[model samples]
Target: MILIKFLFITAILYLGPVVGQQECVKKFMDLSLVKYRAQNIGTESMTGQFMASYTLRVLWEYQFNCSCVNITSLILGINIRRVTDSRRLFPSVQVFTPKGSQYNLVTGSERIIYYTTSNVSTNGMIEYPLDPPIKVTNGDVLAISQPFKKASVVRVYYINGINFSSSMEYHIGSKNIDTSNFLVSNELILVYPVTSGYCVNSTNSITAEFVKKKALEIQRSQPFYYLSQYIYPQIVFSCNGSVTKWIFGAYSMGSLSRPELQIWRQLGPNNYNKIGSSLINATKMIGSNLYEFIPEVPLQFQEGDMFGVYSNNMVNGDSLILYEQRESGPMNLRIGPRLVSPLSTISFLKLYQFTNDYPLVTVEISQSTDLEESSTTEYSGSPYPSQLISKPSQSLSVSAKWLIGGIIGAITIISLASILVLACIIVFIKKRVNLHNSTDYSIIDTRKDDTKKDDTKQDDTLIMNDMTSVTPMQDNSAYGSTHDAAVNENPAYDSYSDGTYLYMSNNLYATVDEVKQDQDDDQYI
Candidate 1:
């Protein structure tokens, strides 16, 4: 009897928590699982625009009987492509209790229950967590208000083909929302915590395995053509799970006609089949003009499967420009062929993907173990070879080497050009100084020659006067003696052609005979 009692107690102890946990988990799942969601069918259907400084209020009627429920988060379906910067797209979220006839106020008092800000990273439906999760009872009318700031525009999807006869209440910037003809639910999702008991955990506790699949890391080469015609740039990737979302870069000349984006699966080498297509709205583009595509249903791709993007909207011979990497270098693991025509495949395109599992985690985690062993067991033996997903580190190393080489070459060229210019300037200045000195020397030499010529002419004239006066003096001795004496006494006296000897002192003149007589009288005295 003791043994039986012991077994019974042991069984109860083991099964009690397990049974309780299962029940608790179910309750939590029912509570936390998304109850009401406005779904978007395709990218083309999202045409509603929410501008900045305007508050968009969406009314949700609670129909559950859980007594008291916890609101965990809010999921907003937004087109991120319209924003210039995803980081700048901040909108304040508020939960309110609806008032009477006025849809703007929750109650007559307009009481706010919960408030938080949304952090948007990518273009798609994003989940915003609420701190101190809101608690609500049954039959409560809840309003989700999103106030957009200045310069913030969000593209929202609306439920198509539904008519509202004043029963549904929604407001845009203090104005009554009228979807009188068709029913439109601006895709707003509310999240709740499913389990209430200690054994149950919230859904947010579970972490998802994220994988990134990139086509090419580097930009493609030149010879790019503006795709005025239908051109499909496809990227081939092998993923086992469903593709939730995709992002790609594009250049638009802002044509009136909308461009169409299509996805295709590869059946064989160079053969592809269309899966889904969407009309890309140019007005809803974000940073770098990248567009995000989220299908109504997640598209699943098997292992070693190939996918491509077909873009069509070439009006007035407008081309969809693409960068093509022509040179042979390290190719991306997800890189595929550039299908120009039905029979032509010579170039490559740039593309990337986010998968359910890490593409390079296996390659990164198994460096210590043997390559063969690691390849077979790592990350559940990902079908892709390590060489494929492993970032062409070797190629990157080589490319880095080339990049450094190119930089060095550029620096060298600039330095050489600078030195050549400096040298040329120096030579020019030296030549200018030399020419100036030569000019100065020529001027000095010319001045010296002119002075020497003047001196030579003066000496010649004095010699001619002395020779002519010598013959005349010999013919007249007495007169010549008197004249010589007078000339000696009055050194300033001069004999003119009129035969008058004049003595000049300062500005006064006297006869030479008078000057000689005065000199003789002074000698006698």
Candidate 2:
């Protein structure tokens, strides 16, 4: 009965009010991660997207913890190819305390306790609930690892927008996650994460211009067909720095369609690659105009690098691309020297492929991190642009966090050892005290027995040897003085000849008297 009552009370205490609050919150609030899902609304999840995957795909999202909120679930859209053997895709999610940067996520003492769900069968989106929601505070990183093997293919969406460089990290082959192996792409994953509370909207606005040596030298804007991706191949070794704003022929398809700026770099002669990119929902105007954009994460460019424009929106291709005709014929926008202001340097002079009509474009470059940005609630409305997630300065530094953790761990181990040593000392002291007291008690008891023996013994009597017992004196007269002295001398009178020897030594010729006295005392005492 007692156990039953205790269990009933425990059940009431745990499951009762929590369920009530959850129901209340669910009924009253908009539970969807509507602010983060601003871009994917109305259209298919992967609309205007390029799908790419690696040997090992690991995406780490730096969740902006506006409030101490619980992430209830994630809406994941993964494409799984047919498997031949016993292989299956297992999509999993794990949470981590923000320690080091996302580049070093797999290193050090990691909390790798993962929650795995059943395999996603199709290429559709599914809301995998977090069974028990994972709570997150400010500066926490959420890791999403989709089950993938070499045989299976998973659709990874890549578009333009404000996102971290480490957001879409991939590891190749069976090797561990190395910082160098991560891919920096133009994919801004606005993954929808249902939160139990409100998350701040990520909206960004930047107004900057590209570099221009001469402002008055205007060029004609030419019309060109829009491709999925465009880069300035000829504008290599021109102006190199962080691009703040890019103006391509005053208005390319940028004014007609939404495009993300992709920064491509040339590491060696044949080693050209896309290093960074930005996604923004800049407004499309009616006529020719310049489009302004800002990246959430800062992008750096070298001296021999070029920038490009990308769009995942294949549905709208009737956009304008600014280019020039130096060979006396209409040229392709894929070919460089589009209407961009030149630095008039030796490298810029040798970069232009046309000498005739070329579309004029401008790009602004800055060496400092002083770009002004304004926020908005536009993420909930129009095509969501992008914003940089600012890290807190008040939080512990990476080195400080490591030091404090080491100190705490050392202190814990030392404390446990000290407790064990103290406990052993206490036990030893208790046992020593018990043993000392017992020894004292034994000595005291033995002394008490010796004292009683001394009290019964005569003061002048010297015990030459140990005796079994002493005979008590008689109250009535049983013998003469000689018999009394002889009886007193014998500690125990037995039928032995020691007393006879003593009597003969005291009186040599008194054998008859001694024998008569002994016979009188006892026939065989």
Candidate 3:
């Protein structure tokens, strides 16, 4: 048992890192440290003409919530417009560490680590994957910057006053020059290698408990470039539920006094009454541009009520709230683009409630026994409550479908090729058989002609033997005279007398009559 325990401990020691790595991979696939939704509501380009030496830079900072297991890549949304075919642009990414205060513009170590160049025309969000991943840990201050070198118009999606707590800062300048936060917008940039391989220790942490829901609504508004000393924009939202918390994004100068966040409820169309008021305080700044405002006391709101957050600051400075001109609010107070607009257009806000109560049901039951004893019981609520269903299985991805189709297509092509080869083989076999049959017929005809010639030669040989017999018998005089007389007296001999002739040793003689007479006499004998 001691040996087994030792072996088991050793196994765990060896497998712990492996299991951690697997969990890290899963976390990387599902989590993101920073993400900003891109919008095409507006675009900013280089104000002047294109110059090869000219460079534009934008800086942003992000704060991580958890210790990063690994940082594999960085993604930024870029828009390239009116780019010519012959023109090209090289965009480089730089990361830095903050040097001084978290809310100030101080940077320390800098690295020009990643760079990419593109010539293809692109209009909207384009992703650039970093080759070498950056490693980071918890609470690491990350400052990211992008420098573009080209004549083409390039735009990055941004929100105005999106980061107010100084968590994010933007600076624009020439290449290798110090940047300033003059006209910088909150850029949509993201870093990878999110929280993984870590378990949540507590869900009731201060930040998690306060913010239960993510920002639900984002209204896109134009950047408020001009600042007025006594005027501020009012933002209205139609909301429901007893709001326990309110968050707003804005941009302000650090020297300005705290602004008042006024909550208003709509009585009728274009009529709003102030309901609740809270002094705006910066909770957290996501990036250099976005600022968060959380009320001290949770404001309660009814259903279908038009609510609004109005900034009461009356100072004209570089600090201004960003809003879009889109038609989104249910009611409007100001008619035109006055000093104080009725509604600030594009803003990000979240509403949360801490306690939500459900209705209760009670039941009572009474039972009586045959022996006259009775009992009463009470039941409340549910014995078995329904749980939320798990998510359905995901369908096959595009790459998987393409792979299956390619395999099927290859099989079909092979089948067609095989059938074509088989047909060619069959046709060749038939042609060979036809050629062989024609050759056999020619051989048979030659053999028949040779046989006929042999029979004719045999007949000619028999005739020659008869002629020789006549010549040999000519030496016998008595026999020859009697044979001659016999041949001439025969009536058959007359048949040969007209043309029968014999030639021997250059001398010609008419012996056909004798020959015919001899033949007739021989037959009779």
Candidate 4:
């Protein structure tokens, strides 16, 4: 029983750390901090110790663990050593292609050879990506080396392929220098230092005077002729170098302004080799310090983040409450490019109002008199705190005006469209009514004219037949009188065969008939 208990305890202790480490690895992988953290490990020189270990495939998979083994606040820069040896020669011997015919080796017998050093510790050999794979040994002809340094007299050379037998003897001065086996080429190359600047020192506490002195010294070192003789004539620092030394040595002279401290904090006692290092440092330092007064929340802002300020006691007409989220964290609000101080409450309120009463604010942490123990303070607010106030952007009024104008324009367009549509509808209705009225008139006129024309034609035919019958009875006076009486009965027919009268009457009748026919055709079709 005792042995089993001991084994169980041992297993628990052993597995606990393994499980925790696995969890850490999982978190790091999910975060993608491997590459990001590795890049920041050693900015200038490899000071921070980092080790990554991959657990070999056990049952089915592989796992890894990456961690920082050591942490230091200081990063130092190391200078690169240049090639100083003098025995090396320049420009390898150039040999023309072998031919039976005689050819002169013109103007290339004697030449200067130069060499250059690379920051990479290896022989500076980078393998090329091959298209068609070529079978070669590991120690194959990688690339031809160039001169390590260059002078007015020095030059460079290149050779392809490795010397297999007698590799050492094949160097510079050898009897059997098989130049035929190696392909030779040469070109001029430029060399620059890997590192141009170095960090001198780092401390948590730095005075403001030291920074100003350094700045002044840098100004003095600039072109003196340009400073004194030409422009900036009022500048008179006769003992410029000596004065700089005394001012810098004092270390107790410059002002401890907010901007200067912010600059130092951003530098963060770390190595900075890349460009914009100073600006980055300044921003970071100021931002981190500002975070103390600014509340931490998921600031839903794109034009940088947002921070707020608060003061229980404030003076009138003083710029006090000032806040801005310049970067990721809260920053001191700027009034026309000048930083507002926290002590000035009135300015803070004005700036706050200017920024639309941004409500994300933090409380002033109370100081503890006892230094030995830590204390936690509670405030009367929700988990996620905020000081809400109503103040919309001034631009919102302009936006509202634009919105109203758009609405008005849309309404006007719709009204005009409706009026046009109504007019078109009325015109269409009027045209339809006119067409119906014209058709009615044509039908009435055609019916009346048709009856009159039929009656006239019958009358004319009857008259002709009567006249022929009466010619046989020319002497009969009774028959002639009877015909005359019948004609007189219908006195409306003044002429039965008058061509002018008949033509006029027939044309009027034909016009009426044609109109009626057109109406009928329209209905049929």
Candidate 5:
């Protein structure tokens, strides 16, 4: 019961008396983009009266909901009105039943509908009604469909008094909107533009005239073709040196029209800074903080920025090409060590082409500030018009030589470092060996006295011999004090026994003592 009540209330909200009285506003709008063809509106024919003007093709779609519960019959009408003016633009008598789809629609269907074209005669209003309202609820969808009818397109007329170069503004609806208060975070404003001119010398009037004539001749040789894309001319602004954002727009032409537009951010402090870095010579500053890291303008532009049709797969065509400068005007666009302009500004242009066998096309930029004048030699090997080939192999070989030389130098330095380290290690080992040899100690002990000493001490030697001989025949009790006293006389002797003898004056005896002590400690632990 609650759901039914809610549906009833929603139906009233959508189809109330107030809403029924007013027409539904459309949501979609589109404008066609045309290429660089001269406007046909003003071109005069041999007849001299006037030319048939062109129309701007437009497309739009609108949606509506149907909600009628248990209804048997009803009539509905639709009206089309220009948003700028409240007046309707189609006939009012013609009506239509909301169509479901192109395939689902047929003749004699009860829910079928029809419509009429611009009834500007009737103040531009179109209306249609449903014969019987098919049982529909709050969720039922109703769609009205039809092709573009008469006067649906915007008419372009030739007016002798009107100017072709002036700007025009059109609104989708005349409803007043407060866009002035809307905040814009990023925006681009073109300040100044660069123009084409030739250098003049005061001393030679004929030479200057000849140069101008040659320029004009070149222009004549390549007839100008109006391009479709909008181009933003190169702008040079005298900023307070605090501007942190900009945008670069360019286009690709040829068989594949892959147009690319980018908004590059100038790197700097995240928050705005009052003072910027000092300026330097205006060479391209790559991988720096002042080059790419800021907000950019949001809009589409067109002018004459043209480039080659970049073709990689199909290698037989000439590509559309554009130029960018790596330098700036007289004063370097930098602050301290930070550079302002790194990648060059894009320059879109219009130029002609030659046949496949034509000579290498050379592009040169004359020096104006810190950058020296330089030229690029481009070759066209074949007749394919959309591809850009690299420079000759001979140039690449020259560059490769320098790269190889640097690599070799780096390797040599690393090798020398390794050798120095190895020499130091060898010296350290030799010093360690010398230290061990100088500290080494050994003991020499005599087991027997010399015969000469015995001869000199004949009385004492006889007594010693007599005692040794008696000890060999003595019992345990008799030899106990004597043998103990004899062993004590040799303070270096650790153990002594009469029947067995063993010598242990080497380091192995000390090692065995240490192992035995460790075993005793392990058992205690």
Candidate 6:
């Protein structure tokens, strides 16, 4: 019982440092700190609390919730706590391909690697490095099938809480797992998963400041000239991973308040679309004429990604963002000019390649963080001990803005079509109103002519009434016939200053002198 207590304390010391290790995958990983944990299955009450012993064919299986592409785990290091200290029998280390739910039916690997209890050294973790690295697929499964007798009992640790842990289940001796009547545990496989994500001798990853320094050094060393034309530049990345840095050459281009040119993202061979405004805005100058774009949240790309920049060729030397035009460069770097065209056209990324000086731009790539820690189902999110789970990127990324961009374009087209229909309706209504007003005006003009004729008739009637009201003196001339009877009675004579009387009879007006002269000559007689 005293020996059982010592092993339990030793297990805690081995795993305590895990809390203080770097949260992210670093350039180098320790082999001892990077493998998963198993539960202690001993029946002894005191011993079973910290360490578990295999009761016959008990198989410990754990599953990852992600698909592994360029990721692989080469070393298998385990801390076998306690055993009989001398025995021929040991546990079987095995691998299995995953089907549905990671806990799915397992199709075992080609060969099973065995670990013997011949040298039971509890000083530290035991290491086994495979000659060929393990091939990983989507939802890969790693298992340990324990095959031992009662006296030859060996114990493994059942860690209650830790990072990079997978959900564990108890299975029979075979590699295959049966879902019916299966049991789960309060514990998880505690692991410090280290990978070859970044190597010590790797030259693949770099920073934006480094790229900027290198390009400036090249410019000063050799006599370099700019591409003397307004152009859109493109750099086709040959490496396959998420691009973390994009450095543009610095020049005396006057300060721009907004993005002068467009930046585009290429997902596939022919797929091209405008990236978010966050990427193109280089208004934030770190120092002098230098311009660099570093996103607050970086996106992952499994691509030979190509990027393009559009600028005005007619602008002055101080107008556009400048990059060194290199006559000769790394053979891996393939860059040229991409003419601007409408996004709807298939000819948008017009790989209209040019053969000479290339843009002195820098690009770098890194492995995805998807290999960090997968989601745990049965053991995770439970209200047990919350402080143990290290969920750093627990709440972000995997955004599909590219799909969203296509949806927005479709909405824009629909909006334009609606506006066009509304315009046509307005034009049609305007024409109908104009035609109605023209017809109404023609009828109004005819009514005005009739009104003028009626006015003339009224004036004529008034003149006749005035003449009929004048009383005329009765004519006594014998020559007067029926014409004299038609004369109107004269009211009064209007005399003038010359003593001439105005005689108006039968609608005829005459002066008094003319009437008197006629009487004097006996015209009446």
Ranking according to TM-score, highest score first = 1, 2, 6, 3, 4, 5
lDDT of 4 by residue, 341-364 (tens): 322122221221011111112222
Q: Per-residue lDDT of 1-525 in model 1, one digit per residue for the tens?
A: 343344444434432211122221121111111111001101112223232234454444233245556555544433321122221333433334324433333223222222111122211224545565555544333343434433333332232222211124334334333324222343322222222322222222311111010011111122222222222221222222345544434455654444333444433222335554444444434344444445566554332333332333345645432222221111121222232222122121222211110000000000111111111111112212222222111222222344445565556566666877997899779767754543321112343455454333321122222233222223423223323222100101111121111212211213322121121010111
Tens digits of per-residue lDDT, candidate 6, 1-525, equal: 343344445434433222111221111112111110001111112111112334212223333344543223322222221121232244444455644433443343322323322222111233333334444454455555444332222223333321222224354355454434344444332221223343211122222233222222221111112221112222332222354544444443454412222234443333345442232344554443334566555534432233433432323543444443222221111111222222321232333222123333333345442433333211122111122333333221122222333455556556666877997899779767754543321112343455453332321122222233421223213213443222100101111121111122211212322121111010111
User: What does the lDDT read for residue 274 in candidate 3?
Assistant: 55
TM-score of 1: 0.26
What C-alpha lDDT, on a 0 to 100 scale, does residue 168 get in candidate 2? 39
- Name the lDDT of candidate 5: 0.21
Residue-level lDDT for 360 in candidate 2: 30
User: Which candidate achieves the best lDDT against the true structure?
Assistant: 2
Clashes of 2: 23
* Superposition error at 524 for model 6 (Å): 99
Supply candidate 5's per-residue lDDT for 62: 10
Cα lDDT tens digits, model 2, 241-332, are 46555433223333344445566654332233677766544353322343344555557654345555543332355344333211111111
lDDT of each: 0.30, 0.35, 0.30, 0.20, 0.21, 0.31
Off by over 4 Å in 4: 1-341, 344-396, 442-525
For residue 300, model 4's alpha carbon misses the true position, in angstroms, by 15
Off by over 4 Å in 1: 1-53, 61-64, 81-89, 98-125, 148-150, 153-155, 163-525
Residues 251-302 of candidate 3: C-alpha lDDT, one tens digit per residue: 4555353444444443322234556655555556544444444555555432
